[model samples]
Target chain A: MIERLKDLWAHRELLWNMTVKELKVKYKRSVLGFAWSFMTPLVMLLVFSIVFSILARGGDVQWYAVFLMSGLLPWLFFVNSLMQSVGSIVANPGLVKKVYFPREILPIAAVGANIFHFVLQMLVFFVFMLLIRWHFSPWLLLMPFILILQVVLTLGLALLVSAANVYLRDVQHFVEVALTALFWLSPIVYPVGLVASQFPKFMPLYLVNPMTNIVLLWEYAIYNPHHYGPQVAYISFWGILITVVFSIVTLVGGYYVFARIERGFAEQI
Target chain B: MEHAVEVREVSKMFKLYHENVRSLKEKVLFFRKRGYEEFWALRDIDLDVEKGETLGIIGANGSGKSTLLKCMTRIIYPTSGKIMTDGSIAALLELGAGFQPDLTGRENVYLNASILGFSRKEVDGKFDEIVAFAELERFIDNYVRNYSSGMYIRLGFAVAISVDPEILIVDEVLAVGDEAFQRKCLDKIDEFRDSGKTIIFVTHNVDVTREICDRVIMLEEGRIVRDGIPKEVVNHYHQVMETEEEASEQGNRKIEITEVRLLNDRGEETNDFYTGSSMKVRVCYEAREPIVDPVFGFSLDDYRGFTAFGTNTALKGLEMGTVAGDGVVEFDLKSLPMLEGRYLVSVAAHSRDEQTVYHWQDKLYQFEMKSDIDDVGLLYIPCEVKTGPQAG
Candidate 1:
């Protein structure tokens, strides 16, 4: 894994070029362009904010908006990155067949591009909080740690989904349905706190969800510091552990599958 | 003291599919439909190249020439083979494989050069030399998409030669560029050859093969049919093509040419029919029809399959009313101007335009011109060159 990391790091220029190409080509002829990256989540955040405010029966729901934003932000990054990377190898079959490079670079490049978009949105998230007087604590310094977790989780999912997609292309379609289901299963719209009270039996299962801890930590760090206590630390620790393990397993497994199947790709393509 | 490259028992098989499944749904259901064909592009190809050796590969289309080069470069892996090389390899298996239409010429040159394993500093070091060699210095900043195909070829060739690789693999890239650029490329290849570098050139041009290659290998249907000195291999290749043409002609019609042989004064199998050499083109044919005014015409074509000169018995107003049944017709040319290359011959029998006994045997016979004399253009247009201290 360290050797693989070193290789990817050395080939960082290729990643930069690919990421820039993807970013430009995606919105090439569109009028909205890069703004669409921000516009999409902003639009989703708006609709979710209105509905949650109405449902929670009117309180100072600024925290509620921040909560929803935090959840949507990471989940959006994961979904977008996974979808793009799942199709990455297939999309660039010409490059893969002609050149000899690590196949994992394709998915990692997509993940890097998505991370760029995620960082841009996070800046907007900060402005949203600044508009309101959401108190910032020393806990905010750990945003980089949370961002790293998000990147790792996204990378793991992208690697797993993209690799599986080569053998079983049905995963691409299934991923969309799974994502929609996961959206509700995660504490995005409402809080995990609400879920614990509403359905006490499923509370432990919710804790196992990597995104649940991620969203919970993001909400705690930004919206409410009092809530960012031992639980957030515990959630962060587990999140880091699971993501690291998931990343390694997905990367190793994906590389094996890619190298094994790559020879057939030229003929298949 | 040793060979620059050694290839042992190299074979490559490619699996080709009828279609590419781009969408996920199509990919998932790909197994339901089954029509795949396996083709052996190369088989049991063994070759050895000494240092500073120029090896030419000559073959028809779909022969294993390009595949062998690709295997040596590791661009595409061989199914079973072992290749040992002494130094770095630079392959021009195709021109313009790495250029991006969206990028500028300068940008694409850098990108493609890097992809070909030249470092950024190396490209920078030879950037001016490459641009000057390509003759695209003025338009270096223009987007490659806007550039013409000639411009693209120039840049590709320039960048490839700049690598100065120890071993260079050239495909049919020279077939496109203009005459001047072709000369430039040939000169560059000669320079590389003289500088103790190894080159593997794949081309259909027999003359180029004979002129530049120390040795030539003939490929037919994914196998090496002949490998030897350039002149011998090329002669054998021409003989094979002539035989195949004769066989095909026999299969097509009632009139069959048993053989078409080019002979000197003493009748022996020889391809070397040079300028001012007494040559006989003997065509043994069997006639199935009652033939009258049977006009037999033979043609001399250059290496490119273009008829250089030809005339028939009836066309020349020599009324030789024909009585033909298993006879041989010979065309004896006194002096042929063609210099130092292979030439193909074709024979035909017809009375007039409508009633044809037999038609064009396009590749019936072949001969070679072994001249040390220099020819200015495509053909030797009898010329005189006098040089001394320039008299103003």
Candidate 2:
């Protein structure tokens, strides 16, 4: 695995070029260009805040728009990265068959392109927090660490699905359906307290999902944890620890599966 | 001699599944083992290529020539054994294989060069030379999707040749481009050869193998059948192909042409004759049952597949009497008025009264004609020189 990282490092220029090409091609002829990236999550935030704040009355959380935006941006990044990376190998059959390079570069480049959009959306979230007169906390500095963990987890899944999709095209559809289910299962649209109160026994199983911890960490960074009571602060610490372990395991497992099937990709694709 | 490439007992096998389950429902519903067959594309192949030697591989379709090339370049790994190469290798398997149509020619050149393992600085250094070689100076900024097919091929060839690798693998990529560009590309290859670069060329064009390759390997049915000097190997490949064709044709025989012989004017069987000499083609056939009015004919073609002359008994208003078991029909040419070159003879028997062709053999027999006088073009017609003052 170290050797593979070294190989990828040697081809860093190729990875960078491919990522830039993806970004350029995505918004090549459009007049709105990069604005679409911010527009998508913001528009989703608007619709969710309207529905949840008016209908459900936010339950007990305040500043619901800020809570929704913080989680929605990261979720969009994860889902978009997986969707693009899953088809990356099969989509470039011409390159896959003709050239010799680290096959993982395709998926890694897809994740890198989406990371650009993720960072942009985070900036928008920061601006919204300031407008809502949210307090500044030194915990915001730790947000990068959490973001890195999320990226690692996403990269692992992307590698596995991209390589597998070369052999089984149904992987793309499976991922689409799986992402929808995962979105509702995680605490993206509603608060984590609602799930804990409704099913206290099932909360342990629900916390095992890496996205659950990731979304809570984003909330911890954006919203002051003191306002959420003692129970919320205690869960955030354990959630961060579980997310770290889960990210490492997923990344390692995904890399192993990707390496095993990559040798046959030229023939299968 | 120092070797540039070495292969020992290498083989590749591909599994052919009875049914490829592309969807989850198909996999879940089918609760039995999926049947499959294994196909061996290369079997325990062993060979060595010395440094600077242009080795040519020739074979019929599906004879594993491209598979061996791909294996050598590591595009696909072998199922067993080992292969080793000494230097940086570049392969041109298919022209324009990675060019994105939406990008401009300038952008694509950089992108394609990088994919071929050139660094950004290296491409920057060679960018001008690549564009000049491709002759796309004025249109370099235009998207490749708008470029003509010829322009696209030129650009692809230019970018491929610009990268100077220690070893090059070319698989019939020169089959495209116009005559001038093809010649230029071949010239560049020759220059590379002079610089002591190892080249592996795979082509079906015998003339190219004879012209450029010092050594040749002939593959058939996933095994090496012949390997030696270009002349002998090419001859063996042609003979093997002819025998295979005859064996396959024999399986579906109604009125089979058992033997075809070329006889001289003195009734001596020979494939070598002088230009303008009378030659006869004797086609001996066997009939499984009695048949009537079967047209017998033969065509004479030059080495380039240009037909010099063709005539049948029906076209000449000649009739052959019916035969039951075995008989021979002979075509006697008054003069073989063709230039000094190797020519192929094809024979056919038709029952179509021009409708059904019972048996047809293409380029089945080859003959050589010699001439003392120097001449050009496909045919040499006898003419009387009458150089005199113009008549008013």
Candidate 3:
């Protein structure tokens, strides 16, 4: 495993160049260029706010638009990276056949490019927060740590799906359906308090989802803590710890799966 | 000399699917003991290529030449045995393979160079040299999608050559681009060779193999048939092709070439002739039934399988109305203008209308031409030069 890391480290320049190629190629002819990255999450935030605000009318939700945007941006990053990286190996058959490099670079580069968009969307979100006159907290520094955890989790899933899709193309479609289902399963538009109040028995199971903790962490750092209540904040604190452990496990597991199947990639792709 | 590459009984097996099970549904639906046919693309082949030697591999399509190169380059793993290489290897298996059409030529150079395992600093140093070699300096900033196919291949080939690899594997990429660019690439390869790099070239052009290779190997049906000096191995490849073609020939049984002979001035059949001497090629044919106005033709090929001269009786205005039974056609030349080399004579009989070919024999008869005068080239043109300054 250390050897594989060293191999990948040795080819870090290739990974960087490929990531740039992805970013450049994605917005090559578009008039707005990379503004699309910031615009996509903003647009999703608008649609979700209009729908969810009407649904949660006369409810105890404050600044639901800001809450939805924060969660939706990260969710979009996760889904988009997986969708693009799943086909990264199969799409670049020419490179896979003609050249020799770490096969994992393809998927990792996809994740890297999407990470750029993720950071850009965050910057845009921060500006919108300032416009709304939101409170500032030193705890906002913890967002980078959460972002690192999210990156690790995203990389693990990207590696798994990208390598799996090479052997079984159905994995791509499977990921699409699974991501859609996972989107509603996690509380991106709705508050976790509603789920906790409605399904008291399943609250623990619901909090087990890493995204639950991720979204709660984002809301805690960006929004007022009283909105979440002390009890919800207590569970979210432990949820963050569980998520950290889960991220490490997934990352290691994903790396092994990727490495085991990478040898036959040249012939299979 | 130490061997640059050594292959020890290397073999590769590929699973040939009747239907590609690209999806899980098919794999489950057609669950069986054996889902695919096994194909051994490379047999247990052993080879040792010395450092600084230029080796050529020649074979018919699907004869495993490319498979062997892939194995040596580690693009594909062998099922059995082992292969060892002494230094960094770069292969031009397919040109411009990883190029993104939407990116500019300059961006693609960096992308492609890094993919070939060059560091960013290395590419920056050689970037100008690569563009100049490809002659794409003006269009470097333009998107590769706008470049012509020639420019794409030129850039691809240029980066591949500029990497300064210790061992280079070229597989027919030079067959693309214009003739001038091809010559330039070949010159670059020659320069690499002079720098003592090991080159393994796979090409169908025999003249290229003769010009560049120090040794050559002929592959047939996943096995090496001949491995020796380039001249001898190429000759063996031609002979094998001729025999295979003859084996597959099924004539219509109208007229069959019974015997073909090369005769000297003495009118005696001989396999040897002297340059600038009178020679005759006699072809005898037997007609199963009566035929009309059959055109008899013969083509002369030099040792490298290049057609030197060819003519048909019909083209020469010879009228043969009706022919039956056994017949003979003789083509006589005042002087054989070929240089010292082995040559092949191919004879064919066809209707004067040129629709129905009675029989066509390729490389049916072989002959040797000897030259006492020292000259280099395929043909010897008789000429005398008398030069004086300011003759006018």
Candidate 4:
């Protein structure tokens, strides 16, 4: 394991270059270029704002766009990285079979590219928060730590699915289906309060989802629910601890799985 | 001196699946029931490349040459044993493998250099030389998507070549590009040799090994059958290939040449000879019916079917009476004209009028020609080079 780490460390430049390639290739010919990164979250916030504010009439939550965008940005990063990385190895058989670099660089680069876009979307989100004059949460001090936890968790899952997708290609399509289901399970579009009040017995099981607490942390920090509507949103001290521990475990476990099966990747790809 | 690369007890086995169960759905359906035939591509092979020595690997297709190179480069792991390299290795298994079309040529050079295990610091210093070698100065900033395939390969090659390393692993990549560029790449390899870096080269072009490698190894059926001097091992490589081929015959047999043998000066039967050495060709004939004034002839042709030397009894003014039963006719070659390479022998028996051929086997016999001469072309010609400033 230490040897592999040293190998990966030596190829760190390749990791950065590949990540840059992914980012540049993603919007290569577009006139708008990286503006699309900020555009996506803004469009989603607009659509959701109209749907919830006018149609659903959820007046219980003030400035609901703030609540939705805070969770939505992180969710987009999670889903996009997973979707992209899951197919990274299979997509680049030329690299996997022909070149000599740490195989983990492919999926890790996928997550790295998403990290750039995630940061961009967060910038857009904060600008909108200032525009709305939304009250700030004291928990915002924990924002950097939450972002790191989310990255660790996302990187782990990305490596797992990408490596798995090489052997079983259906894992690629399965992730697509699973992500759609997982979106609603987590409090991305909906709030944890809605689930806790309606299915109180299952709330404990729901919090067991690492994404649930991770999303709740995002909402707690950015939405600043203490000043807004605690009735529709919730964050727990225990939930924060569970997610922190869960993310690390997932990251370590994901790295282990990736290494064990990486030998088969060239042949399988 | 120490070994630059060590491969000990290395073997690779591939599982050939009957039905590829790649999808998750199919994998679940076929769980623990996937049927595959096992093929071992490499078998307990051991090799050590000494520092600064250039070793050549030559083998027929499916002989595990590529598998061995892949194992050495860590592209694919061996099923058993280990490979250790003492220093950095730059392997050109392929050209332009990881180039993203969207990236500019300038960007891809850095990306490709890193992909081949060169540090950015190394690339930064040699970046200009790489671009110049690729001849892409003006077009370096253009997106690779617009570059021609030739430009793509050149840029890819230039990156790998510019990264000087302790070891270089080349797998037939020099066969690409135009002939001029091929010469440049070979010159680069020669420079690498002069710089005293260890190298492992694999190619189907066995002749290149004679020019470049310090030693040669021939592999067949996943095992090293010959490992020695370049000329001998390459000769063995030809022999292995020759064994896989049989002569095409088309003639009626009133009289047949039952067997053909090549003998050296001492009349010892063999299939190997050297340039300027006496060789004897014995054609063992069986006459089913008596044939008069029959012409017995043989042609020594190189592998390309270009006749190097040929003769006939009639042409040489030899008249034979009726031959019956079994007898041997001998042709003595005072001194072999062959330089190097496998030579095929064909023999025939025909009526004097040439209306009837008794039996003719085309390329039925072969002999390996070894020589000390280093001159090029069809056959070795003895000559002296008179040189220099005042010579006319």
User: Which is the leading candidate under TM-score?
Assistant: 4
**What's candidate 4's DockQ score?**
0.74
lDDT per residue as tens, model 2, B1-392? 36899998999998888888777788778746666799999999999999999999999998899989988987789999888999888789877777877788988888787777777898889899999989999999998989999999999989989998989999998898899999999998998999999999999886688888889999987899989889668866765666455422322356788899999989999989888899999999888877678888899876555778999988988776675788888999989887666677888887736676667787878887778756666678776778889999
| TM-scores of chain B, in order | 0.67, 0.66, 0.70, 0.84
User: Candidate 4: where is the Cα deviation over 4 Å?
Assistant: B28-34, B235-246, B263-268, B272-280, B288-293, B304-309, B316-327, B332-342, B368-392
Error of 1 at B340 (Å): 9.6
Model 2 misplaced regions, further than 4 Å? A131-133, A227-238, B31-33, B239-392
lDDT of 1 at A250: 60
Model 2: per-residue Cα lDDT at residue B72: 90
- Tens digits of per-residue lDDT for model 1, B1-392: 26778889999898676775556668657766846688999999888888888999988788888777767765567789888788777778666665667677887777667555566677889999999999999999988888999999999999989987888888877898899999999999999999989999998887788888999999988899988899778866765665555522423344556678888756776978666566778877776755666677888876555678888877777765655568877777666677666777877766565365565577656777776665544456666779899789
lDDT of 4 by residue, B1-392 (tens): 26998889998999999998777678888988989999999998999999999999999999999999999888899999999989889888999889989899988998898899877898999989999999999999999999998899899899998998899999989888998998898899999999999889999999999999999998888998889989778876775576457476766788888998999999999988998899999999999988888999999876655788899999999998899999888999999877878888889899989899999987888888877888976677888888679856
TM-score of 3: 0.81
Worst 10 residues of 2 chain A by lDDT: A227-236
Q: Which pairs clash (backbone N, Cα, C closer than 3 Å) in model 3?
A: none
Ranking by DockQ: 4, 3, 2, 1
Sort the predicted structures by lDDT, highest score first.
Answer: 4, 3, 2, 1
> Model 3 Cα displacement at B268 (Å)?
24
Where does candidate 3 stray beyond 4 Å?
A227-238, B247-392
What's the TM-score of candidate 1 when only chain A is evaluated?
Answer: 0.86
Order the candidates by TM-score, highest first: 4, 3, 2, 1
My TM-score estimates for the predictions, one after another, are: 0.73, 0.79, 0.81, 0.91
Which model, 2 or 4, shows the larger TM-score?
4
